[model samples]
Target: MTQQNPLPQEDQQVTLISVRDGNISVTSARALVVKAHKIALKIDTALSEPPAWTDEQSLTMIYTHGERVMRLRGVLREQVDTDRITVEPVGEVKEGDRRDYRRADVDARVYARSAGTQSPTEARAAQVALQLAPTSNAFIPQVVNISGSGLGFTAHEVFSAGELIDLRLVLDQPAAALVNVIGQVVRAVRGEGDALNSYAVRFAELSEADQDIIVYTVFSNHFAAEGLSDALDDFDE
Candidate 1:
């Protein structure tokens, strides 16, 4: 009975998942295989920040081989700097199903405030007023994940489900976009940061044009992550 080998070849692309900014920001870091061992792996990654392991002291890789995609989960063995990590494979390697990415995991800035039963029209008017004359009451939240219809952010402001809120979203990727929209709190859960809660809000009756802007914002990063080599090349410089 000889030792098992996980990967036999090299130069394969893998999505190295990691969290940073005190776990307030989670990103899908793309990494290429630098070396493969009998039971461990070393990868070269492009992470925005140093690896901050989540609740589990492990590293997960979404590896695409042939036409089937697979996930390799293992505990962290080393930090090698240069965004590299050695993972000791824990379980057997197997192919996993490919998913249609609905939400983009991001770390953009968003400002939110509780609306307290205001209609969408009223909330929109209030958002515009604050933009012209910004107020201290505005809270900047770290966006965890976002889609066109809803978004989740971690902030100190506690909001109960079903309450209305106004948001000023500043998108600076692909294109610059400053959008104001009304949303209803759908969920709130415990998260990182000093006195923070993760709030999920669904856009409430957004106009067709406004909805389009958000949809583009959500996918812009997705495309940039898959291709757009120039976008990332300049990032390192």
Candidate 2:
């Protein structure tokens, strides 16, 4: 299939998805190489453990490069080795435009409170009220990664898709502060066995100042780790 977006960069972080019997399994992986209509992935070693895959099963690969997020559908082509798998694209690569603010992989602690208790009409109005009020029923979830636009985290509770939630994130670097925002759940993939379910949520009605903090923290942390000042300038441009 034809893709309007540029090809994925090598070594970019990717999430592989395989669905069977109505259950979707997602694994963290990386793109080894990107070719026309195909890509090779360094599969996660855990794939051998349980819920084995078959050649007939199709896969969805999601990855972010720069400000674009691409979700490509493909079928397993070959198992290159115990750790590598090749896949051939089955349809046009789906691309989504992200905010100028870049995403940084982080393991920071996040507390979230579901607004599911409120009616749908009320929830829409509540999200616009600005500050997120702390609640005794708040859940401390592990934030997988974050960007100005959205964040992904893992939680034991299965938060239904389209649910609205309030978040309070504590940042440790580039000046520590608490960030409060309302977000909508975009996707929730349950992990294998008893593992926590992973959720991807998109921020909604965030103030410009709050977004600046998220962007600065992400860029600061990322540049500090990579030690690449040039890339920082490029990101600003």
Q: Top TM-score: which candidate number?
A: 2
TM-score of 2: 0.48
lDDT per prediction? Answer: 0.54, 0.63
Q: Candidate 1, 106: how far from true, in Å?
A: 2.7
| Model 2 misplaced stretches (Cα beyond 4 Å) | 1-99, 117-143, 229-237
Off by over 4 Å in 1: 1-101, 132-141, 190-195, 226-237
What are the candidates' C-alpha RMSDs?
15.1, 16.5
Candidate 1 lDDT score at position 213: 47
Tell me how far candidate 2 lies from the true structure as C-alpha RMSD in angstroms: 16.5
Q: Per-residue alpha-carbon lDDT of model 1 for 139-180, expressed as tens digits?
A: 363545777567888776778888888776665554445567
Model 1 TM-score on a 0 to 1 scale: 0.47
Q: Compare the candidates by lDDT and give the number of the best one.
A: 2
If scored against the real structure, what TM-score would every candidate get?
Answer: 0.47, 0.48
